[model samples]
Target: MASTILVTGGTGTLGRHVVPLLRGAGCSVRVLSRRERPDEDGVVYVTGDLRENAGVAAAVAGCATVLHLAGGPKGDDEATAHLARAAAEAQVKHLVYISVIGADRVPLAWLRSKLAAERAVADSGVPWTTLRAAQFHDLTLAMVEKMAKLPVVPSPGGLRLQPVDAREVAERLVELTLGAPAGLVPDLAGPRVYDLAELSRGYLRARGKRRPLMPVRIPGKAGRAYRAGANLTLEGATLGERTWEDFLSERVA
Candidate 1:
């Protein structure tokens, strides 16, 4: 029988690519989602929310491995714990997690939630591998769109990030799923880092929009964290192939 892998959040950005890769590797894939969808060839789609223990348990049944990627800005701790418990109950062999780089160092609420999820996975007693990566290129584009809508793009001076391609991250994740559960693997970063203001300007230039860049000093712990470079990978870890400029041009064109 082919090894079965359960992919949580299989309908998401990274999942879309990871699922296909796993199928290509001859692994039968079962995707957990919130909505029911028709299963594709060599893939099964199971509708369930991570918050529901019974649903998660059902999704993990008979699966040898799990790709736990369902996470958000809220209830991440509880959600991760629920999934961890489910994986344990189902006796899943390996649990692969996708986490953010510098999650431990960043003071943002979202990062804290991600760190809490990581802790839950560690304590789940299941063999796990966590891949911490920089912000996705899609995430950068979303940020730019949000900022473009605002009257002024608020750029916290000195904030830098190494935004990586989501597809590349997904490919690395697929490779990790086949390996042993190595805890807290090296950080995955992009080709280079750029200041927030400079990136914003790059976006504006790409889109042919002339908007005033407002470099402001945000007054909060989060702002301080950004200014302190909390979002960057300091160890110079695995660099992805895609550059931000290349991503920007492709996205803009």
Candidate 2:
């Protein structure tokens, strides 16, 4: 494969970590973003919005590999389809994607979008690989921080999370991007799992704050899925080294 690689969402949490590592690997990195950014530190910035199918073909042109990570609360399915189609037209060699762990099992709109995005890439005629990873420490921190802001935090009963370090996920993604496409490899999760209560308490303790956590049930199929641990990968998965507590100590402390 050529050394030039295009990374979508190269400004987000995981992308921030992945770009530097790719640069260190002696690969020329091209980042596509909605807004224009000046090129710096040997990285090229291309202005494009994947959601609107704008500048996508130009972004994928002449790049051997495309590391797709751009996502949002919605429209990921459509955006990924746009990217995949463009990549196929450009005759790109490989397309690597990052998806959430419960994408296939969770009864949520966002997860459904992710699953559709996976399908778009798989059927795009470009060789592809997909990694289903747990929530990142950064995202978990954001969640708990918001919860701690409330006078009484509503802890959803049976809702658990296995938060992994974004850097570790980044490293693994870089390894996959450089190598051959392996369709749907094992899930990647944190070293340990923590329930919603435990996660909230950890955040509260880290920030030297206290809040009463009221147990609230998530209604319907989504609730049942959470209670059944459908979001978890207990077996046949790759586990990260960092724990939720490890993240709290460094970030919150």
Candidate 3:
């Protein structure tokens, strides 16, 4: 593999964590972003938008591997396809993607896009790997904060979430990009699973806010899938290095 690695969304949460680790590992990292950035010590900041072919081509060209972390509910499919095509053209050895834990089973809009992106990477003919990780503690806390905006906090009934630390996921991605491509790795999840009410209450306690939780059953197939634990992996899967409470303690401290 070449020494230079291209990282999409290098300024994102996971990217911010992964880029430094990759730099410390002695890899010359290139980051693609819509906005221009000054070059770092070992990171080559290449401004390129993934929506267009030429931009993606510039980012992937001359890079040995790609760690794609830029995507959302909208335009994820298109961007993934474009980035994959560019990587294939550049003969990139590996393309490691960070996907949600239940992309294949969860019916969420963003997860659907991730599942499509997984296909794009696999079908691109470039050796690729995908890691399905649980939601980040930060993200879960953000969700709880949004829920708190409502008059009453309505927790999804029987929804158990395994919120993984973003830093742990970033470390795993860096390790994966350094190794040979291995299709799909076992999911990375938090040490413990917390039900919706419990998680919400934890957040409330941390923030010194008390809100009575109203457990409501989320109706439909997606809710059923969540209630059935489609988002959780089998036994012996959770990485268990960090916990949401730990993350909260750090953030609050």
Candidate 4:
């Protein structure tokens, strides 16, 4: 593998950890961001946007591997499609994309965008690998905080999640990026699954706050999908070692 790697979202939650690991593994890293950042040791910064072909081309050019991670529900599909075309032209050796578990099965708009991005990478004519991960522990905590703001904590009934650590996901992404493209790898999830109410209670326990949780059914197809556990993978999936409680412990410390 060549020593240079391009990570599209190096400033993101997972990318912050991934960039350092890549450098420690003896690879020079380049980060693409709209905002200018000072270049650090063993890392380079490139100012670019994924939406424009010119920006995408500059970032994709002269890289051994491209890590497509920066995206939102509105632009992920088109942005990834543009990246695929640029990467193919550059003949990038490996293109690794991060997606969410149940992206294909879930009926949410964000998941739908992710599924389209995955397909774009597959059809790009470039060597590629896509790994789907469960929700991050940080994301779970954020949701808990949001719900806690209500006078009465409202929890979605029958909603379950397996929130893995972002650091673990970053490590797995780096491992897959360095190796040969394996197409779609097994999904990664946390060690255990917890209901939304239980997770919120765990957060409350960590924060030393007491609140009553009111279970309610979420309306629409998205809600139905989540209630069916569409956002989780429990069959022969790779399990992350860090538990949500462990994450809270770290936060408290």
Candidate 5:
């Protein structure tokens, strides 16, 4: 019998790629969504919301592993806690969590929520692995587009980022699911770091547009931490093969 794995947020950005990869690896995948899709090869769509304990429990029943990737913009901590509790009740053999790189050091509210979620998973008493990855390259491009529409792109000055590929991050998570559930693993990053404005410029250039880039100095602990490079991966991390330039080319071409 193939090992059953339940992937929360299985229709999401990363999940779309992950679902196919796990299926190719011969794992029976059950995706938790708000609505079910028709049966497909190696895939089962289960409808449920992570915010509901009963729903989460039902979705996770009889699964050998659970990949907790469903997170909200602000209430992720609460939602993740509920999922962790449900995973514990279901006696899941392994729980794999996808988190951000600066979750521990950054002072952003979203990052704080992710940290709380990580803690909840650690305390859930299930064998688990938490994989922290740098900002996704797609996220960076989205940011650029949003900022470019504004009068100016407001960002902390002197901030650096190691934007990683979402596909690479998904690959690492799949690898973790097939292996022993270790504790926190090394952060995953891109091959190089780039400044925010430079990255923004790269995005504009890719689309054959030019926009005035203005770097703003944000106040508070979050701004200071960003300027201090708190989001960068230190040592013992995996570097992705695709560079920001390569990512832009792939998208534009």
Candidate 6:
């Protein structure tokens, strides 16, 4: 029988891609979802909420591996800790995690939460692998789309992003989940980097709309961190194939 792998956040953006690939690789997947869901082909759903530490042990039971992907703006550390504790108790063989590139250096509250989540997985007794990736194209697109709604979009100076394809990130994650536990593999980023202004301009062009961009400075230490490119990984990182332009073309109407 194929080993059953547990996937948290299996219905999310990256999870949507990872779960299918895992299934294709002949692994029976058990997804932990907050809402109750019926079983599907080669995959089963276990109702659970990592945040509240509810239904976690049952979800981790009998699984050879646990892919920790459930995350939010906050409480990521707590949620991941909850899952880690359950996995440790279950003696799950492999624990895999997905994190952002600047989790440690960004100086943002949310990034701190992500960094803490990474620590939670590392401290878990189960063997683990964590992959830090750049901002997803989908997320970047949403930001730009929302900004374009205003009469004048505020473009933060020195705010640059290497937006990666979520599918590519998913592919790498599945490879890590299946393979031996390798701690902190190389970071993944997009082929090209674009500033906030450039990204917003691209979005406007794609939508056949125009908006004046107002150059704005990000205030406080967070701004300083961003100005220093703390959120970027320019070297020793695995670059994804899809560019921001490629994603915009396909996603933007």
Against the reference, the lDDT scores of all candidates come to 0.87, 0.94, 0.87, 0.90, 0.87, 0.95
Clashing pairs in 4: none
Q: What lDDT score is found at residue 249 in candidate 4?
A: 92
The digit string of per-residue lDDT tens for model 3 on 123-193 reads: 99999999989989888988888998787999888799999889999988999999999998888998898
What CA RMSD would you report for each candidate? Answer: 1.3, 1.0, 1.5, 1.2, 1.4, 0.6
lDDT of 5 by residue, 39-98 (tens): 688688887776665477888889989998777788778878888888898899999999
Cα lDDT of model 1 by residue, 156-218, tens digit: 777888999989999999999988889888899999889888788888888888888887786
| lDDT, residue 43, candidate 3 | 84
Considering every candidate listed, which one attains the maximal TM-score?
6
Clashes of each: 0, 0, 0, 0, 0, 0
Instruction: Return whichever of 2 and 5 wins on TM-score.
Output: 2
Off by over 4 Å in 3: 236-238
Instruction: Please report how far candidate 4 places residue 117 from its true position, in Å.
Output: 0.3
Model 4 gets an lDDT of: 0.90
Those runs of model 5 whose alpha carbons end farther than 4 Å from true positions after fitting are: 151-155
Q: After superposing candidate 2, which stretches have Cα over 4 Å from the reference?
A: none
User: Model 4: per-residue lDDT, tens digit, 110-188?
Assistant: 8899999999999999999999999999889889989988878998898999999999999999999999999999999
Candidate achieving higher lDDT, 3 or 4:
4
Off by over 4 Å in 4: none
Q: Assess the local accuracy of residue 38 in candidate 6 as a C-alpha lDDT between 0 and 100.
A: 92
TM-scores, all models, native as reference: 0.96, 0.98, 0.95, 0.97, 0.95, 0.99
Error of 1 at 49 (Å): 0.7
Q: Estimate the lDDT of model 2.
A: 0.94
Looking at candidate 3, the ten consecutive residues that score lowest on lDDT are 233-242
